[model samples]
Target: MKTADIQPFFATLKAANPSPQTELEYTSVFELLAAVLLSAQATDVGVNKATRKLFPVANTPQAILALGLESLEGYIKTIGLFRSKAKHLMETCRILVERHDGQVPDTREALEALPGVGRKTANVVLNVAFGQPTMAVDTHIFRVSNRTGLAPGKNPLEVEKQLMRRVPGDYAVDSHHWLILLGRYVCQARKPRCWECLVSSYCDYSPKTPPPQGSLR
Candidate 1:
């Protein structure tokens, strides 16, 4: 998309949600890191449901360390890969206390060095918790970027680079959330609601999906 088209794309998103935030629920950076780690291949709603119960008892690295792996597994066993997630979470907690003074690190290298944290998860932590302007290109973003011609790429790394270069400066910080939310709700995987999309006029997609039949709206 052209730079001109990009302006209005973000303007609409900013106008609608002046201060958007991650749907993941967490009080501290430690909790945020833990929540994001568990969110791999799982929904934010599911992660939040589990974290809500877990965080109340142990929101910090030290606190979670005290919870022990068995107890931690009990809280998050409902999520996928609970056994592995529990192992990683406990190891990450140990690393945090031993290396980063029980706080989540700010840099990508330091953050990714933690057990089970990947590029996408690190990007989320840096962007949301540390106010870094990084985009974590997940499935939703990859699909939207390709479909809308916003930041087309063959892989996540390529898409991340494309977004970094294409997204306007004013919107780069919030683009992650906006694009993810848009793709999750509007530009869905099965049937994209292109006709009702706010930026449909600017999108370069072919054979756009029309509005649903017999809609009240």
Candidate 2:
């Protein structure tokens, strides 16, 4: 999309949902970090299902450390790569407790230093928990950025930089959530629901998908 269309594109998203939030269920910053960690190859629904059981039992770094690796694995065993994720969570908690006094650090450097926390995960925590304007370019954000011509790039890091530079300051902090939701629900990968997309008018994609037979446009 043209730079001129960027404003209204995000404006429409903001009007539709003024306050967007991550689908991952979390009551605390640490919970958010943990949920994002466990969500690498898993869906928010799956992560939430496991975290629902795990958080009540152990929500903090110290509390999670108390659960032991085996128990932690048991709690999240339903998720794919549970063993590795559990191991990473265990190590991350150890670092949080030993290095940061059991508190989730807000800095990108500190967050990325933890086990299992990559740039994407760090960006998510920094944006959602700390209200930073960092873009966590997940598959959803990456696809939406390219598909909508909002910030097309060959890779996630490239896309993230593009978004950081392109997105308006007023919508920067929450733009990640908007693009993610748009991709997840409307500008889908397999087949975009362009017929119902609210911002399709500003999108650059061609031959927008039509509504199914008997479906309302």
Candidate 3:
């Protein structure tokens, strides 16, 4: 996408939803960290469902550590890879308690050092929790970035970097949220609803998909 187009592209998205936010539900930074850690290969709705039951009981790292692996698994077993997620959560809690005073780390390096945390997770934590203008390209964001020619790249890291560079400073903070929502709902993988997409004008995709024939909503 051209530099001039990029501003309007993000501007349209920002206009649609002035205050975009992550769909994953959380109260404290610890809860957000745990939710993101568990969100890999899972939907936000699914993660929120599990966390809704888990948070009240163990919202803190120390509390989750005390919850024990077995009980923790019981709470999140409905989520995919729950067993491994539970294990990672337990070890992460231990590390947080032992190293960081049971608090979620703000820096990428420290966040990535946790058992289940990775570059994407660290980026998300840094962005959502600390209000950093970081991009965490997941499957949805990746697809949208490429399909829209906003920041096409071969991998998540590349796309993230491209987004960091291409996105306007004004939209940098909430761009991830906007792209994620757009991909999840409008620019879907199976069949993009380009007809209703707000930024379709700026999108570089050819043969934009129209709404179902002879139907209007």
**What is the C-alpha RMSD, rounded to one decimal, of candidate 2?**
0.6
| Candidate 3 residue-wise lDDT, 37-85, digit = tens | 9999999999999999999999998899889999999999999999999
Write the number of the candidate with greater TM-score, choosing between 1 and 2: 2
Off by over 4 Å in 2: none
Model 1 alpha-carbon drift over 4 Å, by segment: none
lDDT of 2: 0.95
Model 1: pairs clashing at backbone N, Cα or C within 3 Å: none
Model 2 TM: 0.99
Ordering by TM-score: 2, 3, 1
Q: Summarize candidate 1's per-residue lDDT along 1-217 as a digit string, tens digits.
A: 6668888988998898888899999888888999999999999999999998999998988998999999999999999999999999999999999998898899999998999999999999999998889999999999988888889999999999999999888888889999999999999999889877888888888688877788754
Top candidate (lDDT): 2
Against the unseen true structure, what C-alpha lDDT does each candidate score? Answer: 0.91, 0.95, 0.93
* Candidate 1 Cα deviation (angstroms), residue 135: 0.5
Off by over 4 Å in 3: none
**Per-prediction TM-score, please?**
0.97, 0.99, 0.98
